[model samples]
Target: MRILEGAGTYVATTSNHWEEHLEVPDLSCGTYSLPAGGTDPQSPHTEDEIYLVTHGRATLWTPSGSAPMGPGDVAFVPAGEEHRFIDIVEDFAVVVVFGPAEYSRAESDTD
Candidate 1:
């Protein structure tokens, strides 16, 4: 059992295209603030991904095509689908959830 305060681990900054915070296994949840016109090319994922917009707007570019998403918008990318995000506003922040628990990235202990 664990608890994460999004406001703590999450932050917006330059030089870093985005920030990733592993809240827990099978659930690498975090917030992202993509600079305007920034784009992340297609990437592979071992499991399904859910992206929920917390602020600003973005355009998702999948193999199928591009779709606009904004605050209160949620997008689900099926497993194995090649997808990326583009045309993001500087004020954008999104929460992501990767399911099946087992597929979540293993955490490293720091003692």
Candidate 2:
């Protein structure tokens, strides 16, 4: 088991996203921080994911549509879907969970 103290510490080190494995092999999680007006540079992933907003506000855009997001909001993106956070009104932080653990950019190219 692993315990992380203080989201601020994680937020400080994570410029984009910092991912870590969970106890279960099929699940993984991470935190990302985007300064106001910043954008998420990553593309889509090979595994489904859920984003839990921890701070700030922005609009999550996908091909299907767009929606406003803020603290405590949750968003989901299916595998291979194009999405990004735009028009960041404040410093944004979110916890991302990926299914089939290790399903991030580091592992996507391997498949």
Candidate models: Cα lDDT each: 0.65, 0.75
If scored against the real structure, what TM-score would every candidate get?
0.71, 0.79
**Residue-level error in angstroms, candidate 2, position 63:** 0.5
Tens-place lDDT per residue, model 1, 36-110, is: 566665476766788888767778888789999887788999776788778776556677766643245434475
Backbone collision tally, model 1: 1
lDDT tens digits, residue span 5-65, model 2 = 4442235333465645352667777777887867688788888888888888889999899
TM-score of 2: 0.79
Off by over 4 Å in 1: 1-3, 7-10, 15-26, 101-111
lDDT of residue 98 for candidate 1: 69
**After superposing candidate 2, which stretches have Cα over 4 Å from the reference?**
7-24, 104-111
Candidate 2 lDDT (Cα, 0 to 1): 0.75
| Top candidate when judged by lDDT against the true structure | 2
Q: Roughly what TM-score does model 1 have, to 2 decimal places?
A: 0.71
The TM-score leader among the candidates is: 2
